[model samples]
Target: MGVTLTDSAAKHVANFLQKRGKGIGLRLGVRTSGCSGMAYKLEFVDEVNEDDLIFETSGVKVVVDAKSLPYLEGMELDFAREGLNEGFKFNNPNVKDQCGCGESFNV
Candidate 1:
């Protein structure tokens, strides 16, 4: 399994990249932080390292570094709007626990 973006998420990223005018894809990774010990990080990629792994879905590229792959494998990212607030949501099957605020998780 590999990382993927839902249709809405892909559309959002693609639109942002078009507006920015330069990006090869979105980078998805994990960092050690938060109460649960891990948090997701996302950024638009201008360059991909040679060892990076890329997964394409819905016309968008989801890139991951080798070290982050195990934790992010099979995760699906989604964009949702609830009232006036909107953000990306992580649907990670490997996660076994999440912080109360929902910003971090542990597997």
Candidate 2:
């Protein structure tokens, strides 16, 4: 399976793109960092690489590089608000464990 965005996530990204006015979509990737060795990276894409894999959910396009596909496949992106905190959350099936601080994961 490929990456997907929950309705809330799609709506949030759509709103951001609308506000920014120059994005093609959102980019999802992983970086080598943090205690658990891997961390998620997200950004708005104004331009896409030719090799990027594009998936659409709720009318929003999500772009991911081929190198990140194995790590991010089947992941579900969500947006949530918890009291005073709010942000994007990753529901990654590939994650075996996460660090205690909740900053990174091992897959």
Score each candidate by Cα lDDT.
0.95, 0.95
Pairs in steric clash, model 1: none
lDDT of 1 by residue, 1-107 (tens): 79999999999999999999999999999999999999999999999999899999998999999999999988999999999999999999999999999999998
Q: List the residue pairs that clash in candidate 2.
A: none
Instruction: Kindly list the per-residue Cα lDDT of model 2 for residues 1-107, writing each as its tens digit.
Output: 79999999999999999998889999999999999999999999999998899999999999999999999999999999999999999999999999998889989
TM-score of each: 0.98, 0.97
lDDT for predicted candidate 1 compared with the true structure: 0.95
Candidate 1's C-alpha runs over 4 A off are none
Clash number for candidate 2: 0
Residue runs of model 2 more than 4 Å from their true location after superposition = none
